[model samples]
Target: MSFASYHDNIELGDTVILYLSPTELEAITIKRGGVERNKFGDFPHANMIGKPFGSKIYAMNKRSWIMALYPTPELWTRALPHRTQIIYSTDISLVAMYLNLKPGSVVIESGTGSASLSHAIIRTVAPTGHLHTFEYHEQRAQLARQDFEAHGLSHLVTVRCRDACKEGFGLERVADAVFLDLPSPWDAVESATRALKGPGAKLCSFSPCLEQVQKTCTRLRALGYQDIITYVGLIRHLSFSHTKMQNFVIRPNPKGTNSNKRTAEQSEATDGDAQSVQPSAKRENIEAEDEETQASETAVVGNPGVKWAPIEFATEFMTGRPAPSVRHARPHGIFDLCDTPMLSYCFRGDGLIVQNDQ
Candidate 1:
């Protein structure tokens, strides 16, 4: 039943997750002479003992089978009996991330409702770290302690029955982070400040309403907590699939044929018979035609009777023009192109041709 460590074989008194389907799961403790009955069939606890943790065991009737799974925080969350409203895996992940939780992180949590998040927190800060959780309900606090003990995590967590919002965490400068999930989390902010180990320690409060968040934020600010940010826990599922669509082709209408006269139905009917060319092939053909056109147009012959200046390397290389001469040249200081002489600029090395406009 140890969720803090891994074991290969299912032993007596150990909790196992029975995976019936993707959406169906059950948690059962192995006890001698114990039997579990579901819509599938009867599963004997004796038959599961000594078997591998992941074995697929047949029902007593032998008509159905279910897989035995190693208990992890995630699987346990899915299978654990709900004593109250519990946090799901999505929000649990965000809590861990925002709190900067890791191994050896001392965490303080208030109002351990169903021990769902408690299990996840223990799993995160195991081996050397510890969790101090408080619950206002006395029965839930006792059940949480028992649950932790059954999972072999009693050494790593401390459970107390007390209202943290009123009594505080009852300690100071001990926790690396504090988490609050209470009706009036703002009331507990002062306690959280005392529990945290001074600066750099984080505090998170989970509230269902924006009004509660606002109050919490105000209290945190008044107490000198910095870098306060609010977050809403939301989970969105996206479905992906492969979709195939028909490729289309476009061709110019026949010369002298009025395209406007063609009805939408007629155009659509002709499209079915049009040649189907793959996009890649069409792109290749267009590129090849462009290369040929560029090669043919690159060679230029100067107009007759025009004195052409010797081509400069920069102008010839950049503009692909062989040579350019000043048109209607006047005195060096004057030009008829404009009232004031215009200074034409050109680049060095690889540059475009500079032309003096008339």
Candidate 2:
């Protein structure tokens, strides 16, 4: 059967360890249908190739047993030979979240570091997106490449042996996310920005010291990026048991009693409409009175008790009166009086007298 088919048929319990060749001891390749010699004993792949992946294979002669399949980050961390320090799962999970890395996001990671982080990124951005990782150390890069091939992720990742900081190599197109795991991540900020798509692109760095974070933050700001925040991850496991459930005897306090009372009162208040009617009515009456008083105080005519001034008089003074004076000053006379004089003729004993004024 093909190696790919062989890997597929192996069930959970089958024992398998990727064996390293003599020349490439750093690289671990899947050893099937062959005799694997170790200090403990000789493990024949013929016995294990047909079994399930997790099958417990015990060599009674050697008195050893190993469970198989691809190694998880935790198992790989403990087992993988490392030239540089590997990133822990805690940091890896946080980085993934902050970057918003999905299956199709092209990710650029620096310093493969036993390929622990690389392996995780591959799993996260699988099938669709590709991960291009750079490692300065040749041996480390080679080991990471081998691990990728063994895990069937060789097509998904490209491990380049180049000094990413000095040369800034292997950073081609704009990546959706960039993860820097080097000792001096600030040195790679320029390259990271060049590799990112735009302001939407995300870059995260892992540093153990506060000084490193300060330096990285400065570089990030200089690159015109916003919403930069640095925080440490802390995970604490709580011990829970039926016997240890919180009891009133353990935490006796007035605060707890008050909280319980408040909750009960709120629940009762929401149960029926009768208890809510009085409060709602009182609220409406208070609001209505406040509005009425405000309206009275702002009336157009003066209110002696409430101290309101006439709106018309205020508008006249503020806007200034019209320049042309009226013929009649009184309000009624201005409308009733006519500007032209009235002519009248009267006969005084056969003589005619005409008067222009009326």
Candidate 3:
């Protein structure tokens, strides 16, 4: 069957926690039967499956309602069921985007925590693609395996208890994407680089600090990886309120509505004064100034032939940032002489040859 067809058949369930009294489960009668008994209460599995995800499954007798159809990541994070610290949805989404992960691509993930990210990866790379996740911790690995089996994704996921970085990526073949979420990602960079398909292969490292990013980027560059960029994702949930909106619109705060009004008044006053003067001459002068500025802005900044060189740098090498003095190291190798150098010298593939002096 096609990947799309497989995704359609998968029964994605919403996890709900029911807080019930002692008498609820006994009072309610249901069919496709099994009651998941927790410390708080017992939930009837039969009554939940057919209901829409996020629908509240109310146990009237027990005075409880189960929150249904929440996202899998959310459910896994809250109810780990087993002991494990899981990767949150924020990291998962970023990893998926930066790595360009999709169906049919082979992915290698290490330190599978609670299998939250593993489930997300499986969902993304289904049918044609497969994920080979390694976890050195025995307990975490077992729990992750169980979670995958429960989701019926065991066929697509290969869980192994091995030190992925130390033993090298266990695959006989290279992977399209490699995701490193371990504590020390720098240690695994060499192995990950070897497993990646050089230039086009995507590698992502998840760290909570800039220090880790600095170390990882340094290693990646030394290993001949190009175009390496690092950034953090911050997701802030703003509370939507009509009262706050009205206050922002009507309140005369200096930084908000008051400043906006002052700017508008100043613009109107300037327009009136300009109109009272020689309007035609002023307009012509302003147009001329704008044209001059546009011409200067559009001037060919660098050699039009070379592809990788920054355009503006050639015209005035020291305009924005000082252009590095291209000192020929060994007749072929180009070296830069600058405190803060630009990466224009490292040009590969077919592109316009951007000269330092045009």
Candidate No. with top TM-score: 1
Best by lDDT: 1
Q: For residues 36-114, what per-residue lDDT tens digits would candidate 2 score against the true structure?
A: 5655466566666666655655553757755444455544554567677777678778988999988888999898878
TM-score: model 3 vs. ground truth: 0.58
Better of 2 and 3 by lDDT: 2
At residue 98, give the lDDT of candidate 3: 88
Of 1 and 3, which scores higher on TM-score? 1
Candidate 3, superposed: residue stretches over 4 Å from native: 1-42, 49-54, 60-64, 70-78, 242-358
Winner by lDDT between candidate 3 and candidate 1: 1
lDDT of 1 by residue, 1-358 (tens): 6788988899999999999998999998899999999999999998999999899999999999999999999998899999988888998999999999999999999989999999999999988899999999999999999899989999999999999988888989999999999999999999889889988899999888999999999998999988998877788886656432222111211121222333343455556654543567545654554465343323221233333322233244335554355332111212122121111222443333345654
Which lDDT value does model 3 have at 112? 84
For each candidate, the alpha-carbon lDDT, in order, equals 0.77, 0.60, 0.59
TM-score of each: 0.68, 0.57, 0.58
Better of 1 and 2 by TM-score: 1
Candidates ranked by lDDT:
1, 2, 3
Q: Which stretches in model 1 have alpha-carbon errors above 4 Å?
A: 238-358
| Candidate 1 structure, TM-score to reference | 0.68
Output the TM-score of candidate 2: 0.57
Candidate 3 yields a Cα-based lDDT of: 0.59
